[model samples]
Target: GLNTADLPAKVLANRALLCSELGLADQRIAAAHQVHGARLRCWELDEHPPRFGSGAERSRIEEADGHLTHAGGLGLLVLVADCFPVALSGGGQVAMLHCGWRGVAAGILERAAQEFDASPVAFVGPGIGRCCFEVGDEVRARFGDVPEAASGRMLDLRAVIEARLLAVGVRAFEHLDLCTSCRSDLFFSHRRDGGVTGRQAAVAWLD
Candidate 1:
């Protein structure tokens, strides 16, 4: 569900379940108020004091679409419904990004690449696919005249993201290829469910 929604109790409960499975404490989870921009925040456990539990919840970073950290045992989270959740890890660091069309157009992937010291393996999570993500000329224009991104009027969001990551020197890339819009049983899609829908979270942390 929408883990960072106004419902703090429900959000905490959902997080608790994930932390239990991962053998992590829910208090160490860090999140942001994603604004569909290219801004990325990097946190260090030594330099910046770790925020945990209710403190972390209260101090959710604002106006950032991406988060990166070298801090071990600290979870970074990004919530998405139709937007792609891009996770990157390498050289003892990890990052999670909330990438929407606006974020892609604004160069969020490239901005994220700047945060990594070495080539990172990228894992792209599920989102709307080209089959159902039809768009107009404006959206298509942002990604140029690439065939993979433009299937008639449909836009392949995943393709655009993959191209961007590759261009920024990410070699090892994996995509979940699951279309949230089509897989009604497994995902939440803003397009398929209209404006009112819950969000699925993509979370990553260093071991």
Candidate 2:
């Protein structure tokens, strides 16, 4: 489900619903102010969980594009419209990443992979696929001549993510393969919606 807009009250209400469905307490959900960069922050098991209500919102990380956690009952969420959400889990830890073209080029996956002692299993969630993600010369130059990263004038963002995961020794991985732009009924696409869109969340936590 997409949490519509940046309205705090509405977004919180939607988050509360997701928390209820996931069997988690509202205060235990930890999110970040995503900047579409490769910066990752670790959620320690011993630290206090962030509060969600008014006056306590400062507990959330101010600037980060990814989160890694070895703790249970603390949900790590990455909100996305057209960007890929990559979830990793193994060896008692889990991580969630917000991967757009910039984040991928900045090595967000490789940075997150180093946090796990072993090669973790990955799940690549929905985003804009190559069929609809058209890019100009500047964006294309950042990805080189990788076939999956370029299909004529289009760019496959997930393909770059997959290659990064493989390079980081993550062999066990799954792609949701649903393009957000292509499937408006199922996802929120910023591109398709002309920059006014809700955000879908990819959440992970240790059980």
Candidate 3:
């Protein structure tokens, strides 16, 4: 997951690059947004997904926390600085999830894995590793088992998430050990920024 939170416009501007990577230069390509909760949505060219906003009539990209696609050339986008940008694809379907502790506890991965047509392959993008993701006992308990990370506390989200995936029978997955909190210069961190930080965009598409 790339952190382009502060640069949604830039990420949007890079549509051509996205197209090239997804082999979608000829078709209209779009991205779905990310929210904190566990609501899932699938995207199509006819109906665009909503983005983050406040309004009565919203698009799926605006409201959905994560998205999957069977449409060719279109991309499922997830923006993250420290949160997990989970990308999974199988059975001609690809899905990207913006997972925080809330999402993990909400069982987003399990839902996604079950929703996927075939076995899903996941990529846990750069985020705050257990070394940086410290939490209190209450929050740690929510995620179930707090692993000691950082100066104090035990709640390594990535490790916990990996275990969750395995528990759900999602055997294909990998985590990029880079920690956003540890490397603030390279990646954005909501924690490092005290809540205000830019975002990186993680995207995937079908060929």
Best by TM-score: 2
Each candidate: what lDDT? Answer: 0.82, 0.84, 0.70
Clashes of each: 1, 0, 19
Off by over 4 Å in 1: 1-8, 47-60, 145-147
Candidate 1 to native Cα RMSD, angstroms:
2.5
Checking candidate 1 for backbone clashes, the offending pairs are 27-53
- What number of backbone clashes does candidate 1 have, counting pairs of residues 3 or more apart or in separate chains? 1
**Poorest lDDT segment (10 consecutive residues) of candidate 2:** 52-61
TM-score of each model, in listed order: 0.89, 0.92, 0.79
Candidate 1 matches the true fold with a TM-score of 0.89
Which consecutive 10 residues in model 3 have the weakest lDDT in total?
A: 51-60
Which rank order by lDDT, best down to worst?
2, 1, 3
lDDT of 2 by residue, 1-207 (tens): 222446777766877788888887867777778888999988887875566433356545468899988889888888899999999999999999999999988889999999999999999999999889998988988888356678788998888889889888999988899999989889989999998888887889887
Q: Positional deviation of 44 in candidate 2, in angstroms?
A: 0.8
